[model samples]
Each structure stands twice: as C-alpha cells, then as structure tokens.
Target: MNTQPLDDAGGPTAGELGEHAVIEAIVAAAPSSSNGDDAAVLTHAAPNSQVVATTDMLVEGRHFRRDWSTPEEVGKKAIVQNFADIEAMGARAVAALLAVSVPAETPVSFFERLAAGIESRVAEYSAELVGGDVVSGDQLVISVTAIGSLGGNLPSLRLDRARVGQRVVAHGKIGWSAAGMALLERFGRENVPEDLTEVVAAHCAPYLTPGRGVVARATGATSMTDSSDGLVVDLTTIAARSGVSVDLFAEAIAPGPELVRAGEVLGVDPWQWVLTGGEDHTLVATTANDVPSGFREIGRVGKQSGDPAVTVDGAAPHYHGGWVSF
Candidate 1:
C-alpha cells in the first residue's frame, strides 16, 4: 500500500495502486484492523438477544452520479441507508462489511475519502467496519452488509405487528431529501439558495437519529419501518403486511417551510415530495400506547375492509409516485 499523500489531481488511479494497495488504503482510512485476513470475528451478543442483518447495493450511474455527489457523501449515504434498515427492525448496528468494485481507472483518492466518510458515520453508532473485498470492474459498485443486535429481552419490530386502532407515528425528516434532489436538478449545487443548502445536504447524506428504534420500542411501538421508499409506499407495505389500513393526516405530514419554498421555486406540489419521495430514511411506526418524545402522530391504523391500503384524509392519494427498482 502506498502511504504517499494525494495531491489536488487525486494522485494515482486504482490500476496504479493495485488491488492489494487499494484495500490496504481503504482499511487504513476506516476503523477496521483486520489486515491480511479472510474474515472478521463479530462481537458476542448478550443472552436472549437476536441478530438482524441487511444488505444494500449502490451503482455508479443508477444509484449515484460522481459529478453530483462527492465520494465522501456517497460513502455516508451508503452507510446510513443500510443502518437505517437495522434501526427499523428495532436493533442497534454492531458491525458492517463493505465490498467495493471499481474500474481500474478510478482514483485511489476517491476511495480514501469514501472510507473516511464511512468511518465517520459508523463512529456515530456503536459499530465496526470489519472486513470486505475489492475488485476491478467496468463501473463503481458499493455493497454493504450490516449486522445489528436486538438487545436482550427486546422484541424485534415487525411490519405485521401493526393493528387497527394504533397510531401511526414518525421521527426524523421527511421529504427533505427529495426537495434537495429537486433543487440540485433544477438550480445545480452552486446556484442553490443559501437557505436551502441543508436540503441539498440531506439528499447527499440523510441524517437519522441514533437509537430511534429502541426508543419507539420502549414506548410500546406495535410495528416499525424506515421510510426508505416514501411515506405512502412504506405505510402501504405495513398496511398490506398487517392486514390493516392506514389513514394519514395530510396536515400532520405536510411539507415544512423548506419544502414549501422549494416547491414554489420548482413549480411542483410540495405534497408530491411529502407523499411519494424516497430516501429520507425517516422512521415510521405504529403505537397503541403513548407516542415517544422524538416521534409525532401522523396517522392511524384502520380495518382494510376493501379500501385502499393507505389514504390521505379519507381519500386516495393524488400522487402514487415512489422509487421502483425496476
């Protein structure tokens, strides 16, 4: 591994650094100490605890564009989306393995910054980077596998646990990421307004409050999921799985001032983002008891009864847009 510092031009390409050097540089930048190892040993879990795992993949042109986001931002986004899934299950992240495939021409500095970003975000939670593999490919692809612990005596939150008469609650920002994406598409990053910079930042790397699932679980949450797809899409999933219906209050989940201002600028309805935008990584859960401090009541559960699985103010939503892998 070359220990030489990168200059403004990003120093060397991955081909020049070689696979071993690239992996060494990445591990050096991150929190893992598993050098020259085929596998990493995970920490032991407490008795009666359950482990949850999830994997997500990001592609260069499809999921992210290098010109639109810095390598650090892409790295942070990768970690957040995967970890959010763990939290959605009412578990805390403990470890993660990152696998990266990049063209031989890709810059080594790109991965260094990316590893720094992963290390920074993982440091926020009690987790480690562990070990992974790197390979040369035609394009850049990042895959992360995250492992979490549902602490002793704690039950995992499930989509099927939601029932009729429970309150639908949410914590964390909704629609901000979509608004930021819109801003970037419309005005470009440099031309975006000073006040809306945060919105743009959200799209790059969404911020999720740590331990939200544990808090919701402690407060008697019935079911939980992260709004990775969209408010309506994820809630509809919960409704279908639980064999119930969700009635959302439009006012309760209305776009905030930033979204409203963004809508006016883009001539797009703010509700479009609020109801259909994805990647906010907001936590939405159902509770029969009190709503926790960090969460707000956005809707309620009801009988499915041949109606739409999810609705807004007792009517079908006008916008049915959300992310679809296909």
Candidate 2:
C-alpha cells in the first residue's frame, strides 16, 4: 500500500491502477492467513457449536456521504454494523468478508484508507478479514458478511425467544448517533459544538462492546437484537415475533444530559431520538434472570394485548419514526 499522502485530487485512480493492483493494495492493507485462496476456509466450530452469519450493505450517497464522513469512517461503520448483527445472535465474530464496488475513477488512496479502517475495527473484535472482492461501478458500494461462532451448548439468541415476564435490558447508548447526525445535518461538521464532537463521531462510526451477546446469552438472555433500527422499532419486532408486548420505562431509557443539551440546541425532543433514531447498534435483550453486568433494566415483556406491540410508560409513543430501508 502507498504510504505517502495522495488526496482525491491528484491521487492515482482505480482505473489507472488496474484491477490486479487495486486488489493487491487492499490485501496488503488487510492481510490474513485465511486469504490467498479462491475462498476462505474457516476452522471447525467447537463441540456442539453453530456458525452464525449476517450480511449488510452500504451504498454511497444513500447510506453515507463523502462530504460528511471520511472513507475510513465509512469502512469502520460498514464493518461494525455487520458484526453487530453477528453479536446480536449470541455469537462471537470469527471472520469477515468484504466486497466493494466503486467508480473506476475513484481514488486508490480511498480504498487503502478504507481497508485500514475495516482491518482496525475487525482486529478490535479479534476477527479476521479473510477475503473479499473489488469491482467497478457507478458509485461506491460496500458489503460485508460477518461469520461468528455460537460456542458450545449455548442457544443462538433469536428475536422470537422473548417470553412474558422477562425483563428487557440494554447495553450501550441508544441515541448518540442520531444526535450526532442531527448535529452534522443542522450545524454541519465544522460548526458542531465542542462538547458534541463525540456525538458526531458516534454517527460516523458507532462502537459497541464486543462479546456482549455471549455475556447476555450466558446470563440467560431469552431474546436479543441490536438497536440498528431504533429502540422502539427493534423492541416492537421482538414483541411481535415472541407473541408478547413490551412496556418500556420512560426514565430508564430517557436521553442523558448531553442529549438534552443537543435537544435544546436543535429544538427537537431528545426522547424522539432515543425512541425513533437508529444505527447506534446498542445491544437490547430480554432475560428472565438477573440483568447482566454492563446492562440495565429498561422494560418488561407482557402477553400481547393488541394494537401497539411496544410502548413506553404503558402508552403509545408520539414518535413513531424509525429507519425504514424502503
């Protein structure tokens, strides 16, 4: 990989580098022993263990904007989202495959930075970037397939496993990404408040504690999901699938001080982001046993009554919005 500075303006383009050189750069940026073959050959799973896999895609302009985020941040966000799905299933990520599509004129430096970003995040989770593909297209497109291991004797955490009387628990922030996105959209990146820069970073590349899903599973989590589509929407999915209804506590899940300050600046209710905003990748689970360490009790599951599958303070939420891929 080129170590010198090469901004988009005067850098060598993918078209100029040719496919072979571009792929070699990417592999050099993120090398793995599992690479160099036609396909990645993963190790055998542990005794009585199962393999878990999930895929997610990000398209330039639709999922992200170059003006708002760096190529590195885009790579990290793409990897994080896919790995979060793996963890949500009560598994530990073991390997990942990345596929990228970009215009022929795209800068080679962009991919180098992107590969570094993906490799860094994958390393943080102790997962391997086994193999991937690069292709030419009109716009940048990134797709990741994360492979995980549900270690011996543990059942895969499924959305429909929640039962009536289980306590709903959550780990990690719920609305920081949305708040950051709001800050960026309303104030632009350069003008964001100093105190709110962290929020902006969260929107760019959300982070979650790795292996929390296994912790939740060991702690008797019955159902689990990541807050990729907002708290209410995800819980609603759990409820509908599990034949139960969820009633969240307002105070338990309310926005914190930073969010409150952001709300004041934006004149938008912070609770709206807490309930309706998405992509924080927070872990939410239902457990009949004690709430696991690093997790807080936020709500409880009940027999499905009708109409609203999820509610806060036993009432329907005023903010019904959440990310809809459509």
Candidate 3:
C-alpha cells in the first residue's frame, strides 16, 4: 500500500492517488494490524467480557446527500449510529471496522477527512479502529461494524425484558432530528431558520453520549432500546416482544421551542415528529425502580389489551413510525 500523494493544496483526489494509497491513508490511524493483512486480529481487554457486534450501511442517496452532509459529518454519523447500537445493549464500544465503496473519482481528501472524524469519535470512547475493505462502486456506500465489550458482571439490556408496572424513561432529545429533516426538506439549507440551527445540526450530526446504557443497567432497568427508528416504532418493538403495552404521556413530553418552530414552519403537528421521528438514537429504558439521573419518566408499561402496541395517552399515534429504507 502507498501513501496518498498531496496536491499543491496538500489535498489529493482518490483518482489521483489510486486505491492502494487511499486504503493506506484510512488505516494509518487504525490501532489494529490494518496494513499487509488479510484480516485484523482482536483480543478482549478482559477475559470475562463478552463481545457484542453490530453492522450498519449508509448509501449516498438513501441515507445522506453530499450537498447536505460533509465527509466528516458522514463519518461521525456512521460511527455514532453503530456505536449507539452497542450502547443500547448495555455494553461499551471497543473497536470498529469501516468499509467504503466509492466511485474512482472520489477525492482522497474526502477519505482523509472522514478517517479523521472516525478516529476522533472512536477516541472519545477509547475504542480502536480495526481493519476493513475498500471497493469500487457506482456511488458512495459506507458500512461500519462496531464491536463492544460487556463486563461479565453487567447484564445486557434487551427488548423482551419490559414488563407491566415499569416506567418508560428516556434520556436526550427526541424528534429533533426528524424536525431538522423536515426543515431541510421544506426549505433548503439556506432558508432554515436561525432558531432551528440546533435541530438542524442534530439531524446532520447527532451526538451520542456513551455509557448511558450502562447507567440504565445500574439503575435496574428491565428493558431498554435506542430510539433510532422513532420512539413509537422502537417502543412498539419492545411492547410486542415483551407482550406489554406502553402508554406515553403527552403532558410529560413537552415539545421544545425548536420543534414548535419547526411545526409552525412546516404546517404540521409537532407531536407527530416527537412520536414518529427517527435517527435521534436517544436512550429509552423501562425501569421498575426510579429512573437514573439525567433521564426523565415519560410513560408506563401495562399488559397488552388490544392491537395497537404503543399509544399516546390511551390514543394511537396520528402519524406512522419513522424512516423506512424500503
């Protein structure tokens, strides 16, 4: 493998540098044996820890757009989403392998910036960058597989553990990302209101706080999930899996000013976004005991009595659940 050659501006196009060069650059910061290897070797930090793995893919037009998302933003979003999956299981992210398929004309600088973003986010959790493959494709496709470690003493949070009489609590903002997407779709990036800047950024690059799942586990949470697929959808999954129903209190979930402003601009009910928005990836857990600090009680669990698995104040949600790839 060769290092990417720099242009006059110290940035090179992948077309100019070739495949081997770009691969070498991406693995430069990787902690594993990325160079000159068919596969990277991994060793558990603790003998008793169990490994948890998850994979996600992002396509150019389906998941993101170049005009709206920078290379760094794309990188961070990819890593965070996969990492959130690990955290949702009550584990600590330990390593990641990234694979990318891009057109030959893609710029080497794009990969460089993307690797930097991945490296920075991985470092935030003291995780390693492992090895992955590079391939040629018609358009950009990025896939990330994240590995996590669960301490032998801690129990993994699962969807089927939810039971009646448990409280449904969530930490972090909900519906912000969907609201941001609404803004971007209704009005172009240039026309987005200044008040909605935070939500817009949340959509482009939402922050994932590590260890919140562990906190839920410590607080005796019986069931947990990441709200990546919208609150109603994820909650419905838990409800169906556990044979329990979740009733969300609308009064408990007061819409923020940003969502309100977004609803006003879009001429739609803000509560719809709150219930059905996806990509927020916030931590939602059902606990029989008090919720841990930093999490608020949103609703309660009960025996399933009817067809609808998740409801808002005893009523079905007005809108459908979050993003669907197909």
Candidate 4:
C-alpha cells in the first residue's frame, strides 16, 4: 500500500500516468495537508503561511497559430498563462521553468527573441526565468511551470466562501483579443487597424504584470480564477466550486470596437467572439467592496443549486462555445 510511484526518468512519458492516478500519487507523496488539491495546502495550522506551486502548458497550433504569431509572442504567451494560474490562487509567480521544442532549422534570432520575450514577461510580472530544457521537435511548443508564494493573504481558490450579491469584476479587457482574432481570420491581416492589431498582438502576447494578481486579493474577493480558458469557463469554475451564480452583461464586457469591426468584416455575430473566445488571460474574481478603477463589472455571484451558469443581462450565456482540443 506504500509503493511510491517511480518518477519517469527516460522512458514512458509522465502523461502516460492516468490523470487521476497521477493526482493521487502526487497527493500521496506530498507532505500532507488537509486541502486535497495540488495548488497548495497549509503546512502548519497557522494558515496564511506557506509555499504554492502550479504547472500549465501551451501547445503549438492549438494555443497559437504559428502562421500569425512570432516566436517572442509564443514565449510571452507560454509564461503569462502559468503566471496567471498562480495569480488566480492569490499568489505571486516568483519564478518560471520553461521547456520549448523547436525544429532543427529554426533561426538563432528566433530563440533569442523567444528568450527576450520570456524575459520581457518575467520583467513585466516581476518573475524570473529560473530554469528549463530545450529540445528539437517537429513543431514549436512551449510549456511553463511557475512556483509562487502567498505573501500574507490566504491562498484564494475558485472554491471559497462568498456572500450573496458580491460583485464580480475582471481586471483586463474582456473580449478585445478575440475580436482581434476574428479580424485577422476574416480580414486577412491587412484590413485590421494598428490599434486593433495590437489587440491581436496581446492575444499572442498576454500582459499579466506581477502586481495585477495582488489587485485581485486587495479587492475583498471571495474567490478567484484566471480567464485562460475563457471568461465564462473560469467564472463558471468559481461559481461551481463555491456553489454560487453570476450575472454577466454583454455590454459591460468592455466597449470593444474591434469586435464591431471584426463582426462587420466577417459578417459574423460579434457577440460570439466576445462571449466565448478563449485565451484572454484576465482575472475574473468576486468582490464584496467597490470595484477598483479599470476593473469592469461583468457579473455577480449568488447561491444557486444548479449548473454554474452565467446570465447575460439576467439570462444564461449562450454561444457555440469556443476552441476545444479534443
């Protein structure tokens, strides 16, 4: 009953282990804590004193379209996503461990720019790129794992306490990037504006500076999660985990002119891109007190015994749903 799961040294990839089985193995091996999850649990019963860790990945073609994105964009996207995960837990990502696989003929400047991009993101987030591995592969892929620390506050979870009617606000522009994607897809790169094109750049190059995560904690948030998957997915995660509900207004999702422009160019409904697009990497959190400036109120959370649904102007969120790997 005490057989330690051997670490994968050279053969049999780590993912070959069943996810649930891997989780159980990790929990079994970890220095015990009451919190059954991997993010982090208190070491001593004092609470608010501990270390935290999270790992996340960004796959090629799925997370980014190489035809459209640059190497630096790829690097920044990889780092920021993991950092956002640490942020969602109400912690600061102090360091990054990155792994990148690129083709043999890839340019040397490509790697320098990629490293520069990582350094830029680290500098942006006040995080350091501590270590990583580089290998040759058929396609470009980048994965980053971040270790963070709780600086005095209790680690925030998507599952946590909240009063009914707490305000849910996110710190970043909700749908601009998705609009940018639509613009590029519909207008073939030349038609989009420099302003909106920057949004496209942001979609590729996510900007989650170190201090933004603290802003989530400072706002009296009861629960928090990053918008890596999408706005509704993570909002729904917090709601489901905390047994609450949220009301989101589309108009309040930030006045995205790029959305309008993209919709116009493609003859597609702009709301679909706004409501369901993925990879914005914003922080959707619940707060009881006043929402800070630049933080837009998109929804509210309350007790509801059903699907962790989001309401659009008091109705459920509806769209075809966005990007799926499987």
How accurate locally, in lDDT, is each candidate? 0.86, 0.88, 0.82, 0.65
lDDT of 4 by residue, 210-320 (tens): 666667776567677777666777666676767777778766874467667657766877777667777777877778888855476877776774753666777677763
Clash count list over all predictions? 0, 0, 1, 1
Query: Which window of ten consecutive residues has the lowest lDDT sum in model 4?
Result: 1-10
User: Tens digit of lDDT per residue, candidate 2, span 1-326?
Assistant: 12222234568999999877778877888889999899999787788888889999998877876767777788799888998899899899999898888789888888887888888899988888899999988888999999998887868899999999999999889899999998888877667899988888899888888888889999889889999999989998999999999999998998999999999999999999999999999999999999998899999999998878898899998787699887
The residue ranges of model 1 lying beyond 4 angstroms of the native Cα positions read 1-8, 34-36
Q: List the residue pairs that clash in candidate 1.
A: none
Clashing pairs in 2: none
- Candidates 2 and 3, the one with greater lDDT: 2
Error of 4 at 92 (Å): 1.3
Model 4 segments beyond 4 Å from truth? 1-49, 187-195, 305-308
The residue pairs in collision within model 4 are 125-210
Candidate 2 TM-score to native = 0.95
Name the better of 1 and 4 by lDDT: 1
TM-score for each predicted model, relative to the true structure: 0.95, 0.95, 0.92, 0.79
- The clash number for model 1 is 0
| lDDT tens readout by residue for model 1, 220-267 | 897999998988899989999999999999899888899999999899
Query: Considering TM-score, where higher is better, how would the candidates rank from best to worst?
Result: 2, 1, 3, 4
